[model samples]
Target: MGSNMLFVRDITPRKVNFSLRVKVMKIQIMNGKGYDSGKKTLELIVVDEQGDRIGVNIRHVLKPKFESALREHHHYILRNVVVVDNPVRFRSIHWNHETKLMFTHKSTIIPFESSQWTGPEGFNFLQFSDLKSPVLLKAGVTADVIGRVNSYGNIKQRGQTDDIPSKFINFELKDLSDVVVSCTLWGQFCIDFYNYMKKAGEDQCVIVLIQFGTTKDYIGELTVSSDWNFTSVLIDSDDVPAISDFRARLLELHANDNSVGSLAPMLTPPTNDLTKWFKDVKCVGLDDLRPDNPGIFVVHATIIAILPDEPWSYIACKKCNKKANTVDKNVDLTLNIDELLALERYCKKCGEKPKVQLRFKVSVRVEDDYGTASLTLFETQIQNYFDKSAYELQKSLPEDQDQPDELDELLGKSLLFKLEVSDFNRDRTYANYTVKDATTDSQFIQVFNEKYQTHKAGDDSYSFDVVKESSTSKVTSSTKGDSTSTTDGSQAVDLTADSDNSPLKKRIKTEPGTSPMSFSSSTNKPN
Candidate 1:
């Protein structure tokens, strides 16, 4: 205790007279991005004896002077610190102020031994139910959120900041009330979230506490992204005292309510956002694809040979995915699975000729320096690259050949493939390595390579030293756009092949909804 000891509530801007004693509630060590690249910054949120907290910024030059002395949850006394108006627009909802502290040349942090502090660790966590309130959601403020991890999707990449690309991964955080708040995390935060989830596995409890996270109105849906540089992430680690209480209460809530075990393994990753999905699936070399593992992983490889061993087209059900005996007379597709099943259109065990759609399933051999594997492309990849649906292609080609010779054009062409290794393939029940998606667009591949090219020091972490994406017009692989663009919904430039003999002779896009039954070819003659 000192005569000049100051509480956080009484601190003012540009003050240098008082010595303040506070508990280091949290400390974040992060590498600088954008303009502050190559420099490291230390951010801390310290709480006084009364539980009032203020953020502290330690510059790179003065970081070494106070780095070792600051320990989270420990008492420290600061003297001659510079206080300034905080520039961070969005701050923690409840525990926030207009001013923040900074380190000066004379600033010092001394450990205090004779501690009389008996206060909470200053985490003003926001409730999940309150996330829906217009005042909370619409207000330009940061929030502290703590909840059980429900599910997470692949990375959602948008733009580059100072040549380093920014990424977002979305997941749901469920509180004890069964209320869920969607979270979008960036950079190292995303890495740590999965790191804890992977370590916790399916049986253990994995609760998280994000301090000073951001809130955004993403197309009317509320999402919270942890602040990029300053956000403090507390996962299942025992170092933080709050996690024990959170874990216990969450468990007791479900247990007392008679809900059996810990809320874990809802693994329902999102799929609707194709722009985020197709490219961000984990990229793996051919050697990395294990037979025992079953998941969608990307492979950047060349089309070595089109395996002529399987039929490229088969009669398929329009109402569902089941194979039909022959073409159905009625093309009136029942919208729902129940309605289709009620009308005797969909069946797994029985032979039913539902309104037929021509299925395009082609097996192609792909190879890179790592190894070689057989990959099968479905209808979307086939039509987009070939500029024709399975039905139209079937109508145009000669009936005698199993597949047209033009398919040979795909050989030697490089593609980024989204390969799905299912349990069937793992169990040897299915022979082909199926591709969920594939793209021939070079710009998309450049971004993919930058993201997954090199693994960082930690598990599942990526070296995101990405260059700014080409803003010039692109021939992207996304097809959900207009007739000129490709599948995954990314915009691209006008299509053109390299030379006269290029495999990409006609770069017309074939969007997903191109009906297999809606062919415009009039005669029985081949096109």
Candidate 2:
């Protein structure tokens, strides 16, 4: 027979500390086939602090077995699971009509719930050096951080595909104590917070709460998590705690703020001034400007060609629509049902037909004192700024015969007025400016190019060299001697061009026993 009459023993309870491992005994029920709903019977092993495993048989609900009786003994196994103090708890009671009894439910709540997290009482600021593990932080650890909101959007992924539905307003946070980091927010947060930020102007400082996690980015950069609630508060210099405060000292424990923007290289400076000048300047419609080298003056002008707004249709080959090299379409055409079936009816790259309707072109004009030019705007930039396509603009224009008279009058006239010069081109040949005011012909417009004119003096003269050479015969006589050897010297020639050639290339030559000769050409002389 199995062992019977097992004695029960009582043990003293011991207090458990953090990170201490302990074990408690638990009784489980095991039923056989058709016994209490066709369950299987089994034995389980319970392990203790030293990892010693003990096996015991499970008993039926009504059985006076070892497992069933041991269930009455309650024991403690572990202490607090998280390092932080347990969040505060609140209780709510509910009455159940069926049971006629009151039940209580407990909830965990944070005491200081603002739009953002606040540090401990008397906490001043957090610096990078104060963080024992700056890379990873436990929840509820509050520290002051300074960062800028990034204006860029967010990126998301659903299942395996990348879905960048929203962008972020990016910011770099730093504290006087040495804490510095970047923060980003997406979607509604961006629209709400970032829009306000842009209106608030750039380089504004704000405070934020951040959570750290490992994430795989497209570019492989490690990123941290931030939410609207975590990043909503704006903290100015005056709002920060004084440096002498305890919290301020904690902030100073971390690194300094000197290394902030050093993380990324500088990009090309913004061209806002140039853009503003174009918008202020007046001119005829952008059509008059050439597509190529719209001249040096308007090199920075934003230009674009309007495209068809509506989708186009095409008669595609049942097979490949690839055109035959030979002009004879009928002779070069090859028909095959299978090939035609496989051929794509539409161009996969662009959803429209290979051929489409004409669209209007648009451009922004740039000018200097000496001249003006137009630049084509890219389609994407146009869409971003105007929220319209080139095709849509083209379709809206009146036909050549019905062109507006106002447009004609505006042609060849200045669009921007009262621009202040800010910079000049590398060779000082061109100048850049910003528009401080605008003017119209009706308001007594004064064209800047006309206001400043350059002219050359009419009486300017330059010198040229001319060379002439001539050979001459001379006779000499000596007493009691026939004419001895006659001596002759060549004349010097001037270096100058002839009247028919450019004066710069003229040259004169001289030779012994020869007439002076001069040579000239149309080429300019080297200065």
For lDDT, the strongest prediction is: 1
lDDT of each: 0.59, 0.26
Model 2 lowest lDDT segment of ten: 477-486
Backbone clashes for every candidate come to: 9, 86
lDDT of 1 by residue, 1-527 (tens): 34377788787775566888888866776565444579986778777777677888788877777777777778888887887777663344555568888788878777876346666656777788778876666544677788877655444334211111255567778887878777877766665565455444444456778776777776565667776555667776545566678877877667754332236534334222333544336766676776578877877877767776566655445544344442345756433323433344343434554555565666776776666776666555655467666666766776566687767767777777777777755665343566755665554466556555553223445533424221222233432111111111112222121122223222223221101111111111101
Q: Indicate the residue-level lDDT of 105 in model 2.
A: 21
Model 1 segments beyond 4 Å from truth?
1-5, 14-16, 26-42, 59-64, 105-108, 138-142, 160-165, 191-205, 219-222, 232-234, 238-240, 256-262, 270-527
lDDT value, candidate 1, whole model: 0.59
Q: Candidate 1: TM-score?
A: 0.48
What is the per-residue lDDT of model 2 for residues 420-505, given as tens digits with 9 covering 90 to 100? 22222222322222222232211111122221111122221212111111112111100011010001011122212112221121
Alpha-carbon error at 19 in model 1, in Å?
A: 3.4
